[model samples]
Target chain A: MEMTVLIGLDAASYILTLLLVCIGLVIIFGMMNVVNLAHGEFFLLGAYTVVLLQQYALPFAVILLIAFVVVALVGLVIEELVIRRIYHRFLDTILATWGISLALKQLVIVLFGPGSQQAVAPFAEPVAMFGITYSSYRLFVMGMAILITAATFFILFRTRVGLTARGVIANRQMAACLGVNTRRVDRLTFAFGSGLAGLAGAIMAPLMSVDPQMGVGFLVPAFLSVLVGGTASPLGALWGAGIIGGSNSVVAAIWTPVVAQIAVFSIAIVVIRLWPGGVTGKRKR
Target chain B: MSGYSRQLTVLFWAALIASPLFLDGWNLGLLSQLMIYGIFALSLAFIWGQGGLLCFGQSLFFGLGAYAMALTTKDMIPGIPATTLTGLGLAVILPAVVAGLLGLALFKGRGLYGAYFGIVTLSAAVIAERLAINWSYIGGFNGLLDIPPLRVGWGSWQTELYDPLPFFFVVLVAALGIYLLLLRLERSAFGTVLRGIRDNETRATFLGFETAEYKAAAFAVSGAIAGLAGALFAVQFAFVSPAILGFALATEVLIWVAIGGKTVLLAAFIGAVAVKSVENVLSDTLGQYWLLVLGLLFVVAVVLMPRGLLAPFLQLPLPRALRLSGSKEE
Candidate 1:
């Protein structure tokens, strides 16, 4: 019973992390149509930021906030310089972003060396609830990711900016004609998406090994999540992430972890063939 | 101008055929590798330039071809032929089958656009690599080595392909055959319909042309050629690995096609050889900085010579060169 409880808590934490990353991807790919293959790099940047800030003996909350702001600024710069030009040509954007990803990876290698850096977790204790022992850091990650995802949904569904962004996604020309300032919206949306990715990276740093190539392992799954969750819908992102995360956890518990990843991709491909609009149905107008 | 162009073609073929005789053994080997990659790049051009389908997973077909050849050469099953001919046959057939099935599944969803197509194909390549790595039967990460050289006969006096000369000739013949086949296909009615589809898919659909079928056919043809190249690669390296299906290989082929100028098949071949030769020379000198150079080259190519290196050669203002073509009209 104790082992089962531990497994369930671990699974829940993993699902929450997947949910946060997928939410960021949905905003970037679904709303912006800017297939940022370098989304993982943004996550890496956030983690590094936290590591750098923590070295100065900053509080965990301050480190997280600084990491978020700095990474979001980097996202804005990338949008203005690189992504803006290739918005109309989707394939070109993918290739260019891949180039950026490679460059970012090399940059990280240059800065951090070719070794994995250990991220120090702020909370040292394990929290026990109902006979289940879970790391405090993991519980913190779950709470933060859930809160952020909820806040994002609220802003996207209720705010004027979100409505304008939605209009632009639905019909760019129509949105422009209505004086929506689609260009500004594009930049903010990209930055916001990247910021979320960065936040995920910072949050996940304590759990996983941080290295130059860490982003590569996560990139495909994030893309799989985006593809399986209709490309133009937020609810789809959540559903896709939940399915992938849950299945992966269960399969990994039963079988090998590598097999579980392969199963995730296979299931994604099968799901795509069966429901091209994704599991969340069509995008809402 | 047309006569001059014909003369140039003649000169090019003559140089290509005589190159091995003049070049050293290492150069000959490199040339053979380039020729194989040339075939791979041309396969991409057939789909991307002509068919308007930007398939980022061409490496899947290439790796499939290599694995097929590797498997056949190993004669995994006792009764299967261990000859190079059998290797080549399976290489062509397997990729075609895989591409046909994949194309059917992917081409159905309102085209899926270019980015999605790229992502899906990339995902497939990653999955394939992972599967190969996990399954030791396929040789895994270390790859299959010590593949025997091709033999032409059963007993004494059989020709061995261990030497670079024989291998070069084999690649040349295969490349020539594929080029001719592609040329013929380009001139056929089917080719016309494909070009029509590329230019305007909806209009072609309205005209009763089966756009999806034509795209699938083109994709299959591309896969077949890529597989043939992969087979040649296996023989040349005497090895097979999952790296052949990697994103790096796929992107390199794209760069070759882009640099060569996708307007003509011959241009793609020239581009592939030229780019590989330059990289080989640069890497010998620059070492780790080679990728940095390549990244810069990609950027320059996109910004400056969008049509690729061939554009300047074909369109240069050489005094009366531009006027030469119109002279006959005058």
Candidate 2:
């Protein structure tokens, strides 16, 4: 029974990490019209930030906050300098983002060398819950992800900026006609999305090895989640992530890790085919 | 066709056929690889330029072709020819079948814009590469080796196409055959309907043309040609790997087609050679930064030549001495 609990906890930690990343992707691709293929790179950037701060023996709280702000600023720069000009051209955006991803990956390689870097947990404690042991770090990551999601939902649904963002999403031309400042909304939304990804990366840094190609591993799952959840709903993104994350975890527990990844994508393909509008409600044109 | 235009086509074919003689072995090999890529680009142009399907996972079909060829030779499957020609046939057929099935699911979305189309295909490529890497029988990461070369006859005096010269001729002939077929298809009434569907799918659907069917057919044909190119490529390289179906390779091929200008099939060939030749030079000099240069080139091409490199050539003004617009003169 104890062994089973240990296995389950391990699997849950992995799933929760994936869920957080997917939730961030839902906000980026589902809300904004930007198809950010380089989103995983942002996650990498956040992890690198945490690593860098740790090198200087910075506090974990400070490092996490800095990671969020740094990644958000990077997102803003990308939006203003690159994504702004290529909003309407989807194919061009895909190619450009892929280019950015390549550049970021290479830059990481040049800075950190080609090997995976180890990250140390700032806090050393195993939290005991119901006679089961859990890493405090993993629980913190899971809790923070949930908190961020809640905060994002509140800001998106209950705030003025959130309303303007919805207005822009509904119809960019109409939103501009209504004097909603669609450009600012787009910039802010993109930054918010990148910040969320940064947070995920910073938290995940301790659990996984930080490497140049780490982004590629996360990219497929995040994309599958966004695509399956329907690129139009945050709630749907969470649900999609849950389904994918849970299934992948269960499969990995029963079978090999490789099979789990394959199973998730296979399921995603079937789901997308059956429901072209996605698992969530279709977006209104 | 105009007499001069026909002559130019003949000259182009002649030059391609004789290129191996003038170029060194390594250059000839590179040229052969470029021609295979050219064929793949031309296949993409048919779907993208004519049918308006922005397929990003063309590497899927290319890989299918290569794997089919590789498997047939490596395993010595019965009923499938061990020869390169039979490998080529299987390669083309499998991808066509897969594309036809995939198109049914993809074409259902009402507004399958370029971005979504690209993402979906890219996802497929990712899945394919994963499967390729995991499945060791298909050579996994090390790839399949010792693929036999093409043979022509049963007995003595039979030709074994091992050297660059014979392989070059084979690719040239196959490419020319496909090009002629594409030319004919482009002029057909079916081609016009495809263009009509591209311009306005709703209108074409209203006209009872079954736009989805046309798109699927075009995609299948394109996949088949890409498969042919892949089979030829496998033979040239004498190995097959997951890299054949990588996103980078797919994107590079698409970039070549886009840069060449999708308006004309010939431009696909020109673009493939030009970009690849440039890549060869850049990769030799810049090492890892070659992709950065290629990426910048992609952006610049998108901004300046929206119609692609072929646009300037098509838009060139006629000389005052030969200004007969309506006449079909050479």
Candidate 3:
């Protein structure tokens, strides 16, 4: 019974982390029709925020909030400067964003001198769950993931801006005809997506060493989830993340992490082969 | 080819032939490496610029070829002779077979196109890299080392390429041979059909061509050429690592091909040499920050000049019969 509970928690945490890391990419790709290959770099920037603020005596919550804002502002700048110019040109946008990713990685190396930084997890105590001891911080992260997902769902379905953003994503010309201010919507949506990725990085900073190459490790799995989840649907993100992350956690429990990674990748390929439209079979306009 | 393009090709070849006369051994060795990379870039240019298949994980084939050469030369594979000839042959064949299989899987039914194709290829590369890291029999994360140099003739009469000059000439011959073969193919009827599929796949299918077979063939041919380059690289560098199979090198190849102007073969070749040469010079001066400048340049190039910065000056106009834009039924 304890083993089952442990596996369940592990799977839950995996799903949440994957969802948090990938939601921003899903939004950026689905809504704006941009690849944003530098999504990982934004996550790195968020992690960097925590590393840089280690000297300051502040609560982890304040640090995370600052990281989110910083990443959002950076995303805004990138969107305005680079992404805005190549909106519909998909291939060019990919190459351009890739260039941004490379630049950001090297920039970090230049500033931090190629060494990894560390941070302490905010909640260090052990919590009893189903008669098993677990890291309280991980449990807190899982709760935060649920809260964030609920908040995103509410904002996306119940807000005026969300409606406009959805309208723009569905049909840009039609949305513009309805006076939705499509440009502003695009900008804000991109920023919001980047901010979410940043928050994920901040949340994860304590768990792993923060380095320039750290983003690439997260990027592959996140990308796999986005592809599997169907880029066009928000709900698809959850479904995809659940399938991939849950499977990975279960496999990791049974075998080595490396083998689990390979298994996930193989499964992703098989999924793409069998179901080209991803799990949701939804297409973007 | 047009008269101007013919002249440009001739001039370029002449410059390469004469370069060794003035360049030091160190620079000549670097130039030889560039030529090998040029071959790699040319394969990508053929598939991407002409065949319309944006392969994001081309380094997978290159790395595979390198490993094949290293293993075969080291006599690690049982029952196979460790001759240079066998190693090179295996290099080309292995990647070709792998590519053919992958291409069939990818393009057979409900084929992956454009960005989906690129993403899938990228995933394949990542998986290959990870697998290489874990598979300890082939040296694992550290990779194979001290791969033997290429040799000619047999037994007592064998001649080894210990000096950079001999290797440079060999690479030159290989590059020129591949260039000429690809140029001929560019003008062939098969090339016209490939371009047709690239421009509009459905339309090509309507014209009664087996589009998938042609795509797979192009992919296999491209993989074979890239494999040859990899074999040469391994012999020259005497090292092979998982890094060669991964995303970073793949992206670098894409940038080189893009910057060189993928539409033109020679341009892509030169682009590889130029970008690598620039990297060698700039990385030394700027340290890690050079990547920042390179990134900015890449971004600017992609956004402002999608056709490539060097393409206009280098791309030769095809003969009227072979022109890709005016696709009339032959």
Candidate 4:
């Protein structure tokens, strides 16, 4: 009974973390047709931010906010400079961002050396949950994932930016003609989406040693979740994350992580092949 | 074609043929390896330039080719011949078959295109890399080594090509053969349909052509060429590792094609050779900063010269018979 409970919690935490990682990718790809291959780097930057903040002994909230802001600004600058120049040029955008991803990863290596850094978790303790003791940090991550997803949902639906997004998404020309700063909208959407990725990194950094190559590890799973879930809506992203993360966690529990990785990748590819529209059932536009 | 370009082409081939005179054995071997990469780059150029498919996981096929050669020559796979010729044949055929099958999955029904297609290929390459690392039968992380070099003739008359002179000429001939083959296709009627599908798939579909089959054919041919290059690499390096078929190599090949000129086959080939030469020169001095420099150069190359840095100087005019822009079949 205890093992089953523990496994269920592990599965839920993984699914939520995946959802957090994927929301930004889904939003950026769905809102503006720009595929930011460097989205992984944004997450890396966030994780490193937590490592930097470790010396200062700052509160976890401050560290998360700073990571988000710093990476969001980086995203904004990148969008204005590289991404803005190549709108609707799909291949060019992918290349430019991939170039950025490489450069940023190398830059981190140059700065921090090739070794992984450790960050101390603030809530490193055991908590009793459903009559089973679990790592509190894991539970905290689960909460943060939920809170961030909810916050993102509220921002998109209840805020002005969401309204502007809907307007622009419905008709870019119409929105631009009606005094909407469509370019700024693109800028903010990219920044916010990147900020979410950064937040994911900061929140999850304590679980794993932060490294220059950490981004590539998470990058594929986030991509798979977004691809399998269809980049149509946040709900789709959550659904995709659940399927991916649930299957992966369950498989990892049974087999080795290497096998789980292989299984999930094969499943994702087969899923994409059989259901070209993804599990969300939304056809590619 | 311009008079100057044809002259340049003749001069270039002449210089390549006579390179064994001025260059030593070491430099000749190095140049031969770079030429092999040029062949690999040409495969990408054909698929991306002609078929409008930017296969980010092209190294997957290249790696498969290398393994095919390695396993066959090592006599690891039961019931297969352990000769270089058999290795080379399997190297080409295996990747072609895998590419053909993958094309069936990716290019069917709604079909993945643009970023979706690129991302999927990237994931597939990553997955293959992981599997290669874990599969103990293939040497796992340590990789396979000590593969035999190219041997010619029937049974007892075979002479191993351990020296650089004979190998250099062989690589040169192979590169030239693939180049002419691709150029011939580029000038043929099939090339027209390919360019048409690349520019606008929907229009080609409306015109009653099976774009999927055309794309799959191009992919398989590209895979075959890439596999051939991989076989050459395995023979030259005498080792095969998971790194050969992963993200690192895929990115390197992309940079080569991007810097060379995606549309022009010769320019793309030069892109690989030029980049490899630059790396050979700079890696000693720059050390770890080489990747940073390369990454920045790739970004600049993509931004300022999307057609490739070498494309403009090398864009020879098409044969008059194949030119389609003047109220004809372009």
Candidate 5:
């Protein structure tokens, strides 16, 4: 009974983490049609924010907020300088973002040196459920994931910014004609996406070893989730995160972690082969 | 080719051929590595420039070739002999088959849009790298080492190319051969058809051409050439690792081809050599920050000059013999 409960919790945690890492991508890729290859680097930047500032002994929540704001500001700067000019050119944007990714990674290495850094978990005590013990930090991560995902959903669907962003996403020219500042919408959308990625990094920093190359590990899976979700709706990201993350966790229960990873990738490949537009299909306009 | 471009090509080849006469052992070895990378860049140029496909997983083929060569030469396979020739053949053939099958799968139906295709390839390369790390049979994460040097001649009468000069000549011959063959193909009717499909796939299909098959063929050929480069690299470096077959190298090659000018084969070739050469100098002076400079250059080039820095200067008109008569299209 304990093993089963643990397994269920593990799978759930995996799904939540995957969702947190990829929700930002859904906003950026789905809404703007911009493939920000530097997204993973943005994530790493958040992780670094936690790593570097924690020495001051600040509260974790405050640091987390700082990570989000700092990364969003960085995103805003990048948007003005690089992404804004090439929004219409898909291939060019990819290459340019890839360049940015490289530059950010190297910058991290220069600043932090080549060694991996660790973050102390804020909630260290183990919580018991169904006669099994689990790290409270893990539980916190799960709650945070749910909370942020819900907040993002509300912000994208219920708020005015969300409405304008949706309007721009649906049809940029139409939105522009309706007195919406489409350019501002694009900039904010990108920064919000990037900010979410940074938040994810900060949340995850305590759970894993943090390094300059940490982003690369998460990049493929996150991109795969978004790719499988398509650029149609935020719901596409939810469905993608659930399916890919769910399958990976279940596979990890039965097999070696490496095999589980391979299975997840193979499943993604097969899925893509069958449904090239992704699991959600194209947007309904 | 135009008179100016022809003269430029001749001068370039002449300089490379005579380089070994003046250079010492160390420089010759460096040049050999550059030539190998040139071949790798050329493969990407063929697919991206000619077939209009930007494959983000190109190193998958190159790494496949390296491992294939290393395994074969190390006698890791059951029946196959560990000969240089066998390694070379399998290196070329394996990647070609993989690329052909993948191209077929990807290019079928409406086909993946450019960015979508690139992401899928990127995923494929990362998956391959993970598998390599997990599979202990192929040395797991440490990768294969102690691969033998290239040897020529039959049974008891073989000679190994341990010296830099002889190895340089061998690489030169191979690079020149691949370049000429690719150049010939570029000027052929099939090449024109491929370019047409590239300019507009729907129009080419409407004009009664099998666009998928053409793309698959181009991918296969590119993969084969990349495998050749990988095999040569394995022999030269005497090692093969998962990093060579993964996303990092894939991105590195993209930067090289993008900087050099993917449209013209020679430009891409020179791009690889020049970039690698500059990296050697800059990495020493600027330390690791050199990557930032390169990244800035890459972003600027892609945003402002998609044709690449050298492409505009080197994109000469096709030779009269190679040109499709009355087809004035670029």
Candidate 6:
């Protein structure tokens, strides 16, 4: 019973963090209709920021914020420079972002070498929960993920910036006509998405091996979440994350990580085949 | 095709044919490998340039072809024969079927357009790569090794293409065959219709054409061609790894085609050869930084020069028959 509860808690944490990691992708690929292949690299940049800054002995929360800011700034620069020109060209955006992905990967390898870094997680103390001892750090990560998820939901549905962003997503030309500064929205949306990716990277750094290729490992799973969830709604995304992340975490605990990967993929393929539109997908007829 | 483009195409082939005369055995072998990649690039050039379906995970098909060849020739499968012929056939067929079905599924109903299709393909490649890495039967992360080369003979008695010169000709023949085939298709009415669908699927649908079928068929043909390239790649490489069947190779090929001219088959082929050749030289000097250079070039190719760097030299003004009536195109 105790073991099952612990496993359940772990699974919940995994699902929540997986959602956190992929929400950025959801915003970029789902909401913006721009396929940012470099989304993973933003996450990578975030993790590497933690790796770089943890040496300064700053607070973990401060480091996470810095990671978000740094990556978001980088994203803003890219959006302004390369992405602004290719907004109308879907295929070109893919190639351009892929180029960015390659550059960022190489840049990391050039800066950090190919080896995995040793990133230390904060909050080493164990917390007792219902007669069970759990790592407080893991719990903290879960809390942070939940807090961020709630905050993102609040901002997206509640804030004026979010309203403006959604208005742009709905119709860029219309938003521009209505004085929404669609260009600014595009730039900020991309940066905000990238910032979310960075925060995800910061949180996941300690749990995952901090290598140059780590972002790629996270990318496909996030893609699956968005693909299966449908870009139509956030709740749909959450459900998709739950299915994939939950299965992955559970299977990883029970069997092997490799099996978990394969299993989740199979489930996704099956789900996709059965309902091609994803969870929020509707019939054309 | 215009006279200039025809002459350029002919000259390109002639130079390749005459290359062995000046080049050494090692360079010949390297050129052969690049030719296989040229074939791979042609596959993308056809489907993306002509068909207008930008497959982000083309490496899935390439990798499948390689693994098909590797498994068949190495006698790894329980029931299948281990002949080079069988390997080659399966290599061509497997990826085609997978891609055809996948295309059909994705193109069915409302249909997945643009980035949706690419992401799906990308995910497929990732899954395939992971499966290859995890499956111990296929040798896991170390990958399958010591695969047999292309053989020409009756069943029992066969001569392996061990010599680089002979293999070079074989690969050249295959590449040229694929190139010519793609060019012929590109000029065909089918190619026009494919391009029509690409330019506007809804309009094509309004014209009573099943755009999904067209896309799926184009995707299948592209996969078959890519598979053929992968099969040849396996024989030349004599090893197949999970790396070949994933996002890395997919993106690499995408870069080659984008830089070469995705719209022009010849340009894409040359782009692959040129990039690979340059990498061979730069790996010693720039090392990992070469990827950064490639990334920058890719971005430039996509943003400022969508026609690709080599398109000016390789592409010809299309004749009237290939163009839609009353449609103006440069």
TM-score of each: 0.90, 0.90, 0.96, 0.97, 0.96, 0.95
Q: What DockQ does each prediction reach against the true complex?
A: 0.37, 0.38, 0.67, 0.74, 0.63, 0.65
In DockQ terms, which candidate is top? 4
**Per-residue alpha-carbon lDDT of candidate 1 for residues A1-285, written as tens digits (9 for 90 to 100):** 887877777678777888888888889888887788788888899888877777899888888888778878888998887888778766666666765676676677667777888889998698879787778888899999899999899889899888888888999999999988888999999888888988889988888888877777788777877778787678877877778887888888889888998888888877776666777767321
Please name the candidate that would achieve the greatest TM-score relative to the true structure.
Answer: 4
Sort every candidate by DockQ, greatest first.
Answer: 4, 3, 6, 5, 2, 1
Please compute the TM-score of chain B alone for each predicted structure, in the order given. Answer: 0.90, 0.88, 0.96, 0.96, 0.97, 0.96
lDDT of all predictions: 0.80, 0.79, 0.88, 0.89, 0.90, 0.88
State in Å the error of residue B188, model 3.
Answer: 1.9
- Over 4 Å off, model 3: A283-285, B1-4, B323-330
| Clashing pairs for predicted structure model 2, backbone only | none
The alpha-carbon lDDT assigned to residue B217 of candidate 6 equals: 90
Q: How displaced is residue B16 in candidate 6, in Å?
A: 0.4
CAPRI band for model 5: medium
Q: State the lDDT at B172 in candidate 1.
A: 87
CA displacement after TM-score superposition, residue B76 of candidate 2 (Å) = 3.2
TM-score of chain A, model number 4? 0.96
| DockQ head-to-head 3 vs 4, winner | 4
Candidate number with greatest lDDT: 5
lDDT digits (tens) for residues B1-330 of candidate 2: 233544555677789887876998777778888889999998988888788788878999999998898888665576775765677779999999999878866775564545667777877887888889888878788878877677777767677787877777788888889988986786677777887887778899899987777888888999999999998888888888898887767877888887887756777777888889988887888876776667656655654465687534532233344464464321
Report lDDT (Cα) of residue B10, candidate 2.
Answer: 65
Clashes of 5: 2
Model 6 chain A: lowest-lDDT 10 consecutive positions: A276-285
lDDT (Cα, tens digit) per residue for candidate 4, span A206-233 = 9988999888888888888887887666
Q: Give a tens-digit lDDT track for model 1, residues B1-330.
A: 133544555566678799987999888999999999999988988887778787778899999999889888888646778887888899999999899878877776455546667777777888887788777887889888877777787667677678888888888888888877886787677776787887788899899987888888888999999999999898888998888977668877887877776646777878898889988899888765666566656645643455667633432122343355463311
After TM-score superposition, the amount by which residue A77's alpha carbon in candidate 3 deviates from its true location, in angstroms, is 1.1
lDDT of 1: 0.80
